[model samples]
Target chain A: MTTTTAPVRRPTDESQVSVGIAMVFLLLMAGYFLLPIYWLVVNATKSQRDLVTTNGFWFGEFQLGQNLADLFARDDGVFLRWALNSLLYAGLGAGIGTVLAAMAGYGIAKFDFRGRELLFGFALGGVLVPATALALPLFLMFAGVGLTNTFWSVFLPSIVSPFGVYLSRVYSATIPEEVLEAARVDGAGELRIFFTISVRILTPALVTVFLFQFVAVWNNFLLPLVMLQDSTLYPLTYGLFSWQSQVSRYPELQTLTIVGSLVSVIPLIITFLGLQRFWRAGLTAGSGK
Target chain B: MTQLWRRRTLAALAVAPLVALAACGGASTEPADGAAPGSADCAPTGGPVNLSFTSWVPGVEEAVTLWNQQNPDIQVKVNDVPAGNAGTYSNLFNQLKAGTAPDLSQVEYDSLSSFRLQNGLVDIAACEGVTDAQAKFVDWTWSQVQLGDDGVYAVPQDTGPMALYYRKDLFDAAGIAPPTTWDEYYQAAKTLAAADPAVKITHFPQQDANWFTGLLWQNQANLFDISGDQLSVTVDSPESRQVAEYWQKMIDEQLVATNLQGFSPDLYAAWNSGTVATWVSAAWGYSTIRDNAPDTSGKWAVAPMPQWTAGAKNAGNWGGSTTAVFAGTEHPAEAAKFALWLNTDPASLEILNKEGGLYPASSDAQSLPALSTGVEYYGGEQIFDVFKAASGEVDTDFTWGPTMTDTYRFLSDGFTAALNGQGTLTDALTAAQTQSVDSLKAQGITVGG
Candidate 1:
């Protein structure tokens, strides 16, 4: 038998050098992505005086506790009220939206019902619509029903995530139909089949839908900006934006806004870190391996 | 086949009503507070007149409260719209359009014409307490609230008479005296540059439309010539060209820093650090500077703005607001009464000035003993008196056209483009004029020749 020459490893060669370069590039990109977040964290520790004087990226005297205290104390704990509104809007809205999207997506992907394609097409069309253009029409509609300034105005719109449904549909399609058939053969009802068999297998996709809906509802501005006129009803984004607009005349708010931005992202980070495994699982499963 | 088709038709009919009902149910939910009390409630013996006054600042309510203490029958409730220029204006506009506009509204002088165009303003000329007090206000400001044949649509609440606030120590270091004319101002800037390249009279960012409008006003240029609804565009006038050229020269010489757009948090820090040598500010600018740059106390002095022509007046109002009654107000009389108390009452002015940085409209309010007291932050200078001395000279000839706000923005952008060498002064102004005229026409507003 002819012996194939053993390939030599190129530890110092051009190809190896290129790989090293790529690793450095990726590290730099990672740093670039994380820098704003790092700066936000450092900023939260600063006093209003230090905020203007200190380096934007460096930590000054630790005033995170003090800033939180002041933030809650200012205007008689309006920040707490805004935070509660955001949590309700984001947390509960995302939870409900995720389940609805999952069920809709699973139904579209797994069912052989009539007009399924038309229903899928409708869901797809929702993804193409911009949220801003919908705001006024939504406002008009909501105003007619007398819900324009209430929490329902914000929550109801957030709950309908067409993009989330589409993602869930695509993800759910990969589950082997044989498994669902086997569950059905075992005498499980359709709802029980979905809840027990399909849902357990679709954990990764559900997390993705939840995360997306969470962030979408959290960072939403225009809807809340138009929907809520009362200062007492403002979300963190709208409340901070109101303060931001006045920063030119009242510069003290500049620090408050920066600090507010820092504190605002904490829950998002915690959610991501806590649920990172599911995100990874979704990505891996999405590759169809 | 007949049975299946009939079932499908029945299903369609069943769903149609549900969809219509859902659509109907989704829209009826805007929260609207009750409108102000009607004329019936304005009777002296009527229970009370509850009025809603929409404002974006905090201290003005103190003034309202102060007024209410003396006049218990007329009750004013204050709501702070989100601060910042756009939020304040747009929020008010939205409310007005929704027929939920407050009984009294605070309208910026520059935006007064636009507000008047919507036919949403109440004429206060016939209102009690405003007849003799008209002469007390600065002439230019008095005209801002009056439009289209001098229909007095509002009461002047404050004025922003421009003055040069400079770092005395910085000027001393450069061994140059403060400027009194535009030529001397340019020369002084050059002199300062020769001493230290970093120093400038102030930072002028291109994004601020108000600052440029103030300059154009100082140059005696009107954005529009409003005569009988026919508008004549004058943004390409000699005075505008001159202002543009001066700004370009300052930019080429690198005398003015472009960092301060009046929005930067670092702007106050720069002032404290002495990087910015001077700022052309109105009376309202004092509180911002004093509060932010407390470290530079006593080292700063106020002077008249450098005149555009030799021996010409050296002042332009920065920004001022007025109290106006919306046209939809159910209780025009009560609204007018509340606005009058807010604007012209001496006690109200005292309370407002104490709580907020508002310069009172009433002449008697300006003459208050408290205003004459020296400011510790300004090194014992009776700053209000300095502002008062210059407020009267503010030119009343300037007019706010329907497209004045749009034209002002175009001028700011054009000036920036010119300063950055993207185009010549003449070309920039011409383009700005064309763009503004085009925009006005697009909006169905008439422009004069």
Candidate 2:
């Protein structure tokens, strides 16, 4: 956490009691957040019987290697297929979503368009409606065009994140008017200027948008649940849900669900670790000179 | 039926009930060909056929894979949907509305009438060998697929005839024998409770309205009687009251665990810890006990359900499902063939049973070599023998209505209230009866009040 950069002890400025309380509060919050994942990782490595009988926070008889092997080998590696589907949906959706967001956000912030506020207001309205509330209506809309079970049904909806646009518009204020006018006068076309000069200045903030969109699509359940009927097209979340539901008939899937969940989150972790510097920079950019 | 275990929640989605009505009035009856076999045309679409089948059964794809190998031209793709009454029904409804539903889908027997009402399933009885295959399935299951010789909408896949699953170690330790009648069962409950404060004879889970429906079935409490469009709804009646009052006595005496929910981790742990003794469940429940409480292997055994009258044999049923070929499929004949083989073929049946714990509804499969053998978990007891006997005693005339999802939800709500001390179990039945009749009427099905 970024808390590590902050000194807990400030002998001249703060008392030890406040420092102690702050440290304890931060530790408790971390433990609360990490405990469920820790339980999943620990249980995923255990046999089915051990899952219920043994301590949830500790290891059991090591089935970690076996569990991973069985998970991948299941249904001729269908879990891997789901993983690849998730990657495609999230990675490409986030890439395209970020570019679109940057253009819209920069246009709204920098240009004096007639309906700029009205367009931004619509985006705010989109943010107010939960994705779950939209899934059914979205499903009906897609079904109208014979696109319900297709990849584009999920991918198209994933690329239209209003929150991503909102974040970008707020961050576009960081780009200077002088730099853009200089590029414009130098005969760089508007599209070229937006892509080259404006987009580069908005890089860190756009990374923040990309990460948010990526995780939302990666963990999306209801959209895929409503939109897709084919298991071959399922994302990691829906695939694990289907397996978990069948645990009564096939008890082996209980552990597999646990292990699959643990495995599904690895890419999210990697993405976060790789891009957190850009994300953190975005968070602090508007705060200071 | 609780046969799917932890099934029958809330209600299904807003299904397009008029789709089937439109199909009748629409000019899409052009597929009839190659001479009418019985009721349906039994026609196959021209050219090589590829079929899609959707099911929630574990390892069903492997069975389809087996079928695909032998009939290379008539390939079946298995779509892994969740259990029926969950998202699968809604998914099927969505696909049906979109006209992109699979050639076949798995539907529970209880919900088959609803699907029939919605006209989701195709009439495939006229398909080659389908009429001849009727004699191969058990009497009740065969009836489940047909609608008064008009057509057969599906093939019988599995049955869930009710029986008793008890912990033999706990029973023997308490100096109690397995109960054979309701009176004896009550006596055993008192004995078990007195012997140890920690244990009860069994648990009567409030959420399991499907299980309760099975109990009512044993008493010959038929919920619906359809004549033309008229449906006689009697979920609350003398026979149902007899069964409810009997369980109400146990709940009053605290002989059953009302705190437990069926198919929950708490129920599994209760069985493992010997806090719960017997489970009056279906033939498929044998696997449920074995799989969940793995540490309690060899302590469990199965027997016929306790009778209502002395020396009388009667059985109720819980969960079972059918593989229905959906309408609008271009290849009905090939889909019907795949559905038939998946259920009745000995090799495919074995795969389904071993991998998914499905008790075959096929009469000949009842005597399969694998079924006749002893299972190691039950201390080498030939458990299927008990199931076979129970299967024979299950009343073939116990009919389900088209809006069972709504009826089950109302019953479950009432049952939950009754269990929590708001009403008697008998009152829950009365409420369920009124609500069920209303539900049927609302669905445009005529109901006798």
Candidate 3:
């Protein structure tokens, strides 16, 4: 490999200017993305009076510790309950969703079945439909069954991510049929072969599907808004939105909403950062082949 | 092939619910005649019964807790439903249609007609002492809870009689007294703007249609008139045009700020920094100002809203909500009693005033020691007395239209465009008038111009 390697060329002077401009553009984009989060952090550390009076980007009296204390202590620590509800909804919802999508995708890709294309087409249609359009109808059905305003109402809809199945199908098709045939030749059962061989090959793709569904479930607001009435079952997004609408009457909720927003972002950040390696590995998996 | 067919069938089974559910839309289980499944007796039974109430008022839980402790037999479970008027109404409407509504809901005076027309509220006229307690509340407020002379749908919990709150320091610096008439208000705006370039006499928030409606009401502009079932829309009448034209002139001259949305962060900042001199607000605004602009304490004072004609004492309401019993409640009697108790009982009303910061709609409750005392936040001023006097002057004949939500949305869009200098305020009012007529017609209601 070393003997046949090609030499890389250095950037020309004109290209260097273009590269510099591109770097500047990227830095500006990064600042655009981060300014709101920066504002949130700076404002969350302020007293209720200071929040309105001070500049949004600058530090106030450094009340982050106190704000955090108040956030957890308000309404008998309801924020903590909302956070836990969010984790339960997104965490379990994404986990089960990924497994179901992977199995359905693998079955559709490998099996020579009747109506396979039709089923895939149906799921693709689901991918195109916006979730909000389905919320009201779903709410009515669940209400009919007396299942609404419960945890299952939010979780069940969250687990049915059609886009995840579509992504899994595209990725699973890249696995070679020869590998499965070889496993069959070795007398391994189809289930055993899938568990030991296909699952390993599909790990990177599955991780990508998991992250997408996780974020979608984490940020879902309208479904929970329409479905759940009990505040105890509220996910973070709906809970914060509920608080925000009442700011006109309960002005003190302004600080709580700001601080709660700042706190809600941390778990998502950790989730993305921790799984970033898998995201990259998944993107680059088929490049070598 | 058989296995393949089985797999295909399983996949089809998964999608069946989506189609079926969409087709089976929700329907109201109760009859339109208000014959719900509950005993009509208004007396509260001495048994443990849990009642649910939905409201956005903060610290309402404290009032509920007080009631819960006193009457353990009839416990009220407070649901902190946190959307303001429109959102709460829509949510309650949905639940009512589904036959799963809470026992009681908070309905604003402006939106009460919509709820009553939809049959979302029960006739509480026969509830214990409801008709007799009508004499306890302000006449206009009591009238709002009734449909003509026979239908009583809600209990008046609070009133939002409009008032003028001004920064005394800014007024003194500009050497102008609080204007008691519309002409004086216009002159004071000019004087205040000339004294300080950064200061405006007040802000007319285009996004707040309720506040604009109050101004129109004070001018005696009957935008909507209901005679029997025939609704007439005259939103662009001469009286309304007069009020709109005067505001347009002020906005064109830049004597008042029209860009700030009410209850927005910018408005809060403006109040805190003393850039805006006066706030034309309702009685409920006292708590809003005190909580948001704490440092501005002792610099503010309350007075009656200025009049259209010199020395006229006409006033109008901006925002206030009532506790209405749902028709589908399982415990109608208990729910009715709780609604009455929450609004009229002196002890419960005291908790609402001191903790929840609500201005009382009941005349007797207005004299509660908590409200009668001078407030330190308003510079030792008996602010409630000013609001009390203003409340007494509101036009009892003035009524809210049944399609207020849609009408307000159209008006807000028009006014917001006008405020941004895209068009004149009169033109916006005309557009809003046409839109309101069309929307009401679309609802199959008779409309006349």
Candidate 4:
């Protein structure tokens, strides 16, 4: 491969025009996705009255503090509880789902046990089933044991991500078998070798799995909706929807819905950005020669 | 003849068989077939009684806090529930299925029969202060809890007596006095439309089956007659068609706006912009307009609904709810006690009205600070006086069927079709009548062929 860059060229008019056109298209694509977030942030700063009267895309007043106070303080601080519940479900759910997926994927990749391929096929099949389809069955199963409306009802079902396992197994191929052999020869136990050597090799895959599972759990609507009868037990999605559905009866909820939606989104954005380095790293994980 | 049958059945039926046929509906009139609705004795347990209540009313916690403060031993926990249609009823049904139902739940008047048919409600009549407090509520409200059986299944929480909420300024500017009869209302509607087509005298609420039912209720046009095990569906009667045709004429003549459904954003926008001139709504709907159209405050006034005949004293009702002790509750006595105080106590009634925007079922609410005052939102009109009168005028004979939810859907679809220029309102009622009877029979309710 040539180390020298292609002879440095000044920007010709034609090349500049092409780059400019692509830049415009890229900027437009970014704006398309970010417009709602921008609208949400702008509207979150407005009072309930300003929400209807003012321009939706522009700022109305500096009332984010008051809005938060109102949103959190309304319904006896249930919104804050819902936010915390979202974080708990997503954080713990993703952490556990990723670890389980990593172990199962690593086992299937490194070992030749019977039913290993069958189990891999099952995990791949699990990825095909939408979460909505399982919500009702999960609800009935949870209800059978007097577990519905409990934290475990929503949490128990969320911690099994077959896609995460599939990704982990696929990524596990990147870890050389010689690395595991050397670790075994050095007197490291299987668990220790997987925890230290294999986990390091699977970091990118683990992070991908965690991000996918975290977002899924955080934005999950159907499971919590069916399992939870209590509003206090609701995640952010369900909680916001409850407020939204009542907007006709209580118009002030319109503001809270917007503000609550904005607040709920902050954690997701932070989660994605905080782990974007690893997420990006996973995108190029097996592409290396 | 049907009333005679009901009187006899209430006294003769056994409680055990009723529980077996609960989903087919009898409003389980005694302790259920389980540990729930506990013992029959109305005596309070000497031990600490913890009861859970679920309600859709806003600011319910304030009343619960007061109840908790006064009786620390009988602590009542308030569960936040959305409005009935929003999921409260579904949650209650889920709880009933799981055998984990809350001690008390908010059941709407129209839905009471449906719940009763499912055997979801417990007979609280035997509970202390239940029967004695019957006289405190309006007569119609008292009958709602009874469900044609001798048992008081619930305490009536709120009543939504119908009244005319009109734009006082617009009426005055147009020299149109509030109509006192349906004929006069028709004239006034024409006058408003002729003067300005943009400003309608009222919007026909096509999606609001409850409101239309209220109009029927005022004319003594009840859609159901439950006699023993036999149900008579009367939704397509002369009384219903008379009311339907009058509204149909309004639609054909373009005297009123159409397509504004129940509590939609478009309806609120119309109210705020003064495009809608009058809303024939219930007493509890005061906040709906006040909160949604804050800018249009002090421009409204309340009046009694236009009569069917001149000098007649008939009024409709729209929405009301009861606090029912669930069939699965372990503390029926405690639940009944809380229900009584929540609905009958003056302070609790006042708080419920002021904070939750509820119109109390108790006659004592007529004297509450919330009702007695001249509301600033309605140009200092003693608006509730109209409702208080309307409440008294509601026909005690009017009854809800066991399949009101399905009936509502059928009628709403019909009304939507009628409004869209497909058929007349009378046609809608006739179609709804057949469908309602079919649904009743499908639910194991015996309907007259």
The best candidate in terms of TM-score: 2
TM-score of chain B of each: 0.85, 0.90, 0.88, 0.90
- Model 3: how many Å of interface RMSD? 5.8
Q: Which lDDT tens digits does candidate 1 get at residues B108-154?
A: 77777666655556665655555466776667767777664645777
Interface RMSD of 2: 3.3
The parts of candidate 3 lying over 4 Å away from their true place are: A1-10, A185-187, B1-48
Candidate 3 lDDT by residue in tens digits, A182-232: 999999998898879887788888888888889999999877876776777
Total clashes for model 1 = 13
Instruction: Looking at model 4, give its docking quality level.
Output: acceptable
Question: Per-residue lDDT for B197 in model 3?
Answer: 84
Q: Which runs in model 4 stand beyond 4 Å of their true positions?
A: A1-35, A53-62, A121-125, A229-231, B1-43
Q: lDDT (0-100) at residue B337 of candidate 1? A: 70
Error of 3 at B31 (Å): 10
After superposition, the stretches of candidate 1 with alpha carbons farther than 4 Å from their true spots are A1-22, A60-62, A175-197, A278-289, B1-53, B59-79, B84-104, B123-139, B173-177, B258-261, B265-270, B291-295, B309-314, B344-356, B367-371
Find the candidate with the highest lDDT and give its number: 2
Compared with the real two-chain complex, what DockQ does model 3 have? 0.31
Write down the lDDT that model 1 would get: 0.72
- After TM-score superposition, the amount by which residue A276's alpha carbon in candidate 2 deviates from its true location, in angstroms, is 1.5
DockQ of each: 0.19, 0.45, 0.31, 0.25
Scored against the native two-chain complex, candidate 4 gets a DockQ of 0.25
